[model samples]
Target: MSLKQSPCKDEIIAEAKRLGFYKIGFAKVRSVEKASASQYADWISVGCHGEMSYLDRYHDVRNNPQQLLPSAKTIIVCAASYYPAKKQSIELPQIATYALGRDYHEVLRERLMLLADFVGGETRVCVDTAPLRERYWAVQAGVGFVGRNSQLIIPDAGSYFFLGEILTSIEFPADTPLTQSCLECGRCVDSCPGNAIIGNGAIDARRCLSYLTIEYKGDFPEGFSLGNRLYGCDECQAVCPHNSTPIFTSIPDFEPSDELLSLDKKTISELTPELFSMIFRHSAIKRTKLMGLLRNLKALD
Candidate 1:
């Protein structure tokens, strides 16, 4: 694709919306705030990332987006909501909302690449793999605010969105970040089944059900409780006021499969490896693999 030296922000926004992204904004590349950097350092130092050692490895690169893409003058951030049109009945074992659909990494990256081509520049697409702090940039680009649940909350759309970024050499006018923050209602903090949520968007991943179910590798910890979380938990987001009347996503790729919606305690406990692979062949839930998911079901007993 040809390089656009001065990509128009309006054109970029239009292209992003056309590509199934719900919200998009542009920001100038810069180092994250000192306080943010320090807090991350402290979080890592205290082993808040738990078994996710990758978070421990990328400090400088995460703090500096330019390191991921040299001379990256503008960062284009986009949010794609994954709120399913059909939700599972409350009687079923729970999977996190985000992993209910196709793997967002592939979906977002393919779309971002096309958007990049439209802008035409030396661009690098980041959709959850890179070390960059995505939620921070999402906030910086005015796409949303980071809620206490540690998820980026889009106004009226809730926090069920996946974020992707384009770091390009092309400079564009930066958008103003939303000045507001979450209502500090403490609903997410109180509703956390594992009590993993600390104040100020920080999570103790060691105790976080999402981390335990998806990231942790060993046997379930002693005295730990899973609370019917077969794969991941959504207690916090479920209680957040921002998500009460969520602006559901329009993307077909994010819709839940019948196989997924049909999952219940009986099916999960009887799942064979073949059935597991078939159901989650293209899902983000594949990250947990068969054993991991089966292991999580053990805690449901």
Candidate 2:
């Protein structure tokens, strides 16, 4: 049965706020062929995707939301702030701030599912797991502007957040896109230790520390040192001027666990598969698996 369309955009936004999402917006599910795709294609063509073969699996579906859900009328884009004011101890083997808490995939998927249930229609919740171009959807939905570093930078909230989406047959109003672009501010580009940020909105994921530390399964590239990173690297985001002023997150689910924040090299090196599962069973770190994590630790040494 075709569901009758209603203007529930305001309600959806309100519920999103009540659910603790920092921001919510909407956009029409349409074909996108921006430079983003071309750049991604170039990256994939050169094998920059490394061992992440899933990225190459759904090229058409990932590029176009309509392909994922033909009947989908709107895309609900949401961002949840994961920023922590206090930095983790440098002596510890660092995990990304996003992984310090409950797995964002689980936390965000649950919230997005509730939204879908509230709307009551054919809908799907997509966190980081999906093939969708999440940042593009977020910008199209008017949640924030893509910065020079290619991270979505909200005016008030900065880039220390996660983006998620819900594709549904319901249409909603979208917010206005940000008018001010990064004014040739090369802070992020200049600050990138791995020199990943090439230019405005361009990133060589192959050289990106985050990609190397978390996504790549093999040994670290020649001359590239993992240092203290045990999970994901946030050096680029940490150095962005927009992210300079620490944004405190109120979501308890996002708070870093004491064990996660205090994990030392000794702990990580000695972590068995069973211990790894026990500690990160509810965290996104599980994505790397025990062997993958050990591989990352070895790179750091």
Model 1 clash pairs? 4-120
Cα lDDT tens digits, model 2, 1-301, are 7565553888888888788788888888887766778888877787766667888888888889888888898999989888765558887778877778888888888988987877667788899887899988888888888888888888766888888899997766656655567545687777776788766586777887777777777765566567777788777777777776756776788887788777877888898888989999999888888888888877774
Residue 22 error, candidate 2, Å: 0.8
lDDT tens digits, residue span 1-301, model 1: 6343655788778888899999998899999999999988999999889989999887889999999998799999999888888888877888888888888988899999999888876889999999999998988899999888898998877898899999988888899987678988998888887789987899999889889999998998666668778888888888999988887777888889898998988888898999889988999999999899888888874
C-alpha RMSD for every candidate: 1.6, 2.3
Weakest ten-residue segment in model 2 by summed lDDT: 175-184
Best by TM-score: 1
TM-score, per-candidate, Cα-based: 0.95, 0.91
List candidate 2 segments past 4 Å from native. 1-7, 34-36, 85-87, 221-224
Measured with C-alpha atoms, the lDDT of residue 115 in candidate 1 is: 95
For model 1, the stretches where C-alpha displacement exceeds 4 angstroms are 1-7
